[model samples]
Target: MQSNDGPAIDETSSSSSSSSSSSSSSFSSFSSSSVTVTITKLTTNKRKSMLTVNGYEFHFKDYNKAKTIKFLRCASRNCGILLHKSFSDEFVRFSGKMTDHSHLPNTAALGIRTLREKLRQRAEHERLPLQEIAEQEVRAGLLTGHNLLHNRRKLMPPLPQSCDFNIPDEYRKDYLNRDRLLLHDSYDPQFQLHESVYKRPEGRTLVWSSDVQLKLLFDSEKLYMDGTFCTAPPNFNQVYIIQVIHHETFKLYLFH
Candidate 1:
């Protein structure tokens, strides 16, 4: 004999899904050709999962799939839009939020927000040059080249701008004109800075190869560097030497 009774299926569980179609069709057009959008963080707090997807910001609403299925709600108190995003194997899809925005988006706000978000996204321990990032924007055509320095400053944190109340206007002008050299100066025309290394500070640590045996300099391995106080000339108390051995011939070439 068999029982006719069956396990009850909770209607509430089934109602959780908003779509009636298969999951494939539901996610196929998440970021379709018509959508030109970017996801940016709305806050710095890690626990408070607030993000702006294509200019529309939303706050965390729920957690699923080990907290990967991020369900979010519009941050604006007046707005009731909900957002759906998933990450398993790859991005499943993003949906639920309306793309229309109420306020007019200005260039200054967008520029500052993008820069700040970029700096925040980078690992806190990594060496990043904020000023250099600003300059690169001009080269990349994100900002105009005519007012290069002013545009660069806009991209960087305006610490100097707030603190430079006592600084002479002329000094600020000088910074605008030549400060680009501080992070990017090389006496040797042959050796150029890597494009990735757009920013560095003004300091004595920066150096380069110079002089005889220089021909073999680029061709060598096992480069050696040492400084001697005892053997240096009177005018030069400390003399540093860099020597390298040829890769093929195994000949040592010394350069001071």
Candidate 2:
């Protein structure tokens, strides 16, 4: 009888210990899951600039989670100025106008409506049917073709000077005599100046390349060049020439 009684007491103690351990573990899990941090606004003694525009004063407020402080403007319609609470503390004490509580149309209200309309238009445009795009594209192409033909005829009028067959001897002579120096001295001086400047800088070198070389290399790599601009010379009215050399084959390519 005494041995049986000892075993029963031991079993009861073990059950109580296990239950206490389980309850502690459950409480710890609950405590961790329920834990949350709340941020509250705190008043600071720092004074900031307050702008009073139209009849309203705006104030800057300190927020705990914000990187930069936010400004709170007066809710008055006529006065849209921002007031600093620290700076406006004295003003608020005497002026009954501090809390006028009037609803005036401010810049914020104006901008809010405009932004909403813009967003709505953007959403509507995004939802447009593909058929509308196809129709617009077709119309644009037809209009562009018509404008091009009309401009070409107007620009290229029938005149003695307009004919490409006629070449003036004076113009030809002027072209040949324009480059009497044979080589451009400006190129060497500019290159030498840049090289000298870069030599003093660590891990730097002065390099120059033309658009033609850039285009050729891009094409060889199956890439395309974009954002190209073409301008005609005053007298010649022709595109500028660009030259490129192939890296592997050493072949020259010219583009205009």
Candidate 3:
């Protein structure tokens, strides 16, 4: 949990943000000064907030509630007009639309956003894994199918870009940081990285090696390897092999 700016996303939580193709809605009429937009929590990245105003979904993409500076957009793919807003002393106000958008606001994408937010919240607060969450969302009629959901712990796309996928911003969240091992070894830099990607088995292997493990590998006469197929990365069903050796004194060593 990090709170200087906002809480960090759960390390295991994959970004499930995507656009909807079949839904549509339009902003009827909004007066920048007359209406106060309420920013509500969503399953979106911590920086963003989602609101449904008169059937249209408005996504506040880059918001600093403390500083009163924010950027907004309609969630619809066809009409994603970026908007601006600022607040001070409890007063909320939005500027006229900034980027190009539909003459009518599309609500289908907002519905998708809302659904995604709900799915993300389920993954977070309910303490459920991505498989459960993805299945539940589809069971609830949110998604059809996405291979990314099956491997939540690895190979996640970067968080949705509020600006654009090609152009990244400071606000964009980077999703893959799976090495809990790094945190424990950060204070000491003795760990050496030996990573190899395999094609035949269709997976990758990573090893954090130290000098003491090398001496064990060289000193032992009989070497052994223990492989398990029940657990692995990216695919989760591949085989992972660990090198092992028995020392002269009958001590066992493992390098994986």
TM-score of each prediction: 0.29, 0.17, 0.28
Q: Which candidate gets the maximum TM-score versus the true structure?
A: 1
Which is the better candidate, 1 or 3, if ranked by TM-score?
A: 1
Candidate 3 residue 74 Cα shift, in angstroms, is 5.0
116-140 in candidate 1: lDDT tens per residue?
A: 5454544344466856664554455
- Of candidate 2, the 10-residue stretch with the lowest lDDT total is 17-26
Tens-digit per-residue lDDT, 20-87, candidate 3: 32222222343344454344333334433344444445554565544445555566656645444444
Summed backbone clashes in each candidate are 0, 13, 7
- Model 1: weakest 10-residue lDDT segment is 17-26
Better of 2 and 3 by TM-score: 3
Which ranges of candidate 2 are over 4 A from the true structure? 1-128, 144-147, 155-256
Residue lDDT tens for model 2, 118-236:
44444457766656654554464454778888878796533343212332333222222332221112223433445545444322222223344555656764432222335632222
Model 1: how far residue 103 lies from native, Å: 4.5
**Superposition error at 220 for model 1 (Å):** 82
Please report the TM-score between candidate 2 and the true structure.
0.17
